[model samples]
Target: MGYIAFTIGFIVFFFVLAFLSTTFSIPADAMLPIGGLLLLVMIIAIAAYAALS
Candidate 1:
């Protein structure tokens, strides 16, 4: 259940980012670094969650 919630939240986060980028004319080049950071955070979060569980 917790994993499912986390997955849903992560998906929603990307969707929101996508919407904002399109609406605000955020450059794709700028988004690359931001996306990489988010991916790193997601990996760390999952690792921490698994360790705690």
Candidate 2:
């Protein structure tokens, strides 16, 4: 169970990192807000999944 969770989180972390790197060309200042919003969305998604399960 721990391994599964770790693997999923690892994949998601890298996926998001790659996406942000490739998709955004803005400055770090601009990216700060975007990253925060994406993090919030990710948290919400995880919370929703937990609630549904």
Off by over 4 Å in 2: 1-14
Which residue pairs show collisions in model 2? none
TM-score, candidate number 2? 0.62
lDDT of 2 by residue, 1-53 (tens): 44555458657866886687678756778767777777777667666666666
Error of 1 at 29 (Å): 0.9
Residue 21 miss distance in model 1 (angstroms): 1.0
What TM-score number comes out for model 1?
Answer: 0.67
Instruction: Provide the lowest-lDDT 10-residue window in model 2.
Output: 1-10
Residue pair clashes in candidate 1: none
